[model samples]
Target: MTDDVTTLAWAYLSRVAEPPCDEIATLVGEVGPLEASHRVAAAEVSDALRERTAARRDIHAAEADLNLLERRGGRLITPDSDEWPTFAFTGFGGAAVRERPQGRPPLVLWAIGPARLDEVAERSAAIVGTRACSSYGEHVAAELANGLAEREVAVVSGGAYGIDGVAHRAALAADGPTVAVLAGGIDVLYPAGHSSLLHRISNAGLLLTEYPPGVRPARHRFLTRNRLVAALGAATVVVEAGVRSGAANTAAWARALGRVVCAVPGPVTSASSMGCHVLLRGGAELVTRADEVVELVGRAGEFADEEPRPTGPLDGLSDAEKQVYEALPARGVRSADEIAVASGLAPTAVLGPLAMLEIAGLARRDDGCWRLVRTSP
Candidate 1:
């Protein structure tokens, strides 16, 4: 199919199609996107689906997102493109062609950042847990992510609060690429608190979303996103989760995909670790470090990590973050607005980096502003 036709077709379908919809996936697969688009436009499909398509057949939003994302250094990758995550499309996710398939993968993935999606997904481990993770859960998550990073294994996680944030931070701190699978549009930073972290991931790692540019993260979207996380990675690791949590959902998806599932043991008394224990008892392997995770996801000796811990806090920050740090006056405080102008980034963008800097002990926040912390002994 022609590039223009293919792009516009998938773009339109993506906006209107409810993802993981087996019917749409099968239809598009049997007949190319261009033909499928024609079918929908001609009212040859189901009345309900045709009505849905008619309502969103105007590709303005998707086209706008394509232009905006390209300008921002990202793109929409489809099955025809080499940058596509073929494993997710063809692996367990794509099984059951003869019978009615149980599930389907995304038609297109919006990727933002420096790392290539194919490379990042090649040998990845997903670390997931509760938003209100405990200290032990947080520590184990960092250890696993850092170790995985040192071995060139890209870390994958929902870029949310708690364990997910810790996993992304640890991988970035280790100077390896990490993919943030956002539930919402890549342009709309949800959880607002992790904007700096997510921005840095997009620069040094990768940002992935199945949603359109302006789509907000709905509760259902998160559940759908967990499957992508499970499908992209070779193994899914539940660091800490409640009895019924998103981490558990990822593990379930991994198990369904016939992928390895691992869980770290937490204190028996802790509520956060209960999910991990459940997975452990339900056939998930017990893993403590990155090497174990690597072994499951890679060939022997590949991604073997001799070093497990990070060197220091500032080691893995993105260039943008480093610029923000450099812009800080050595002896005085600078408001976020001042830092934004100095660093050539927007004021809203500055807040995330500032928050991260403070967490890294490289900067401190005073009354409504920030200042660098003394590092010399």
Candidate 2:
């Protein structure tokens, strides 16, 4: 395996290709990066793929990117590098990501700043919300981030406006390291207006991305980027988001990755809070303060480091009951019809287990419907 060739090829591909390329990631995973790079260099690719790879095969391109990163006081963090976060296990967490449409691990990461990636990723909490957020969201995000940072926990967020921006600034104000995980190239100052905030993150905390220089942010990239933010955090907290917002997507990814997920409730009449409410109803822990977030993430991190809980991985719930319980939300409620549909169980089939679950105190019935009893689990 040619390490240098592989490294340079990953850099080259990162520039030419869109991120989270499932096919390429699978190929690289099956073969080592070196062998995969050699294959692409040899044009051992399908006709459709050859065109893309052939057009971007500049042997010198990776060198230029390296030099640029060096000048910017940054470096590449590849899977082989010690700086790579371990939580990025076996490429994109676990078996769960393979089921996703755009769910693959990043090929290479471009990083700028002082905070170590693993340390920042391991104990962090991703605080994300809508870019056009309400004051309530802003306040919640800032306070939550501040509390976490002041406790010496790293705060991670995208450097967008509203909730993300507030999260970063609050962390800094607390004199704690904050990481900005960008969707675009690390060098590209997205939102253009938040250049100063990005600058502060680069200097005082950390700035990271999978895209190479000159790559601009795209709508798909931001959605795909959610997984990185989700993966970095031991727990992910959503302050507020629209019904169909990116922050909600981040929460979904966190659930898929098995990271602890939490949601901060907001006014019922506010559309900005819909996503958070949805998440809360979907079983994410409900948190309203910075201390709550810190405790949630802290216990989660501690649990992650503990010996595997003999909760038998099934958490002592039978499959049918587990299905029914999962269908119920952490807040609000779900009707039997909804639970049946979600659990893919017939109404008749669900009735018995829901009863048993209620007896076990894992679920509670309300007005003929049911919901998961709120628990730290």
Write model 2 residue lDDT over 159-276, tens digit each, in one string.
9998999999999999998999898887798889999999999999999998888778999889888888988888899998998989999998888777789999988999999998
* Candidate 1 off by > 4 Å: 51-55, 88-102, 299-377
Q: What is the lDDT of candidate 1?
A: 0.81
Error of 1 at 226 (Å): 0.3
Clash totals, every prediction: 0, 0
Best-fitting candidate, scored by TM-score = 2
Q: Pick the lDDT winner.
A: 1
Q: How much is 372 displaced in model 2, in angstroms? A: 24
lDDT of each: 0.81, 0.81
Model 1 Cα shift for residue 10 (angstroms): 1.7
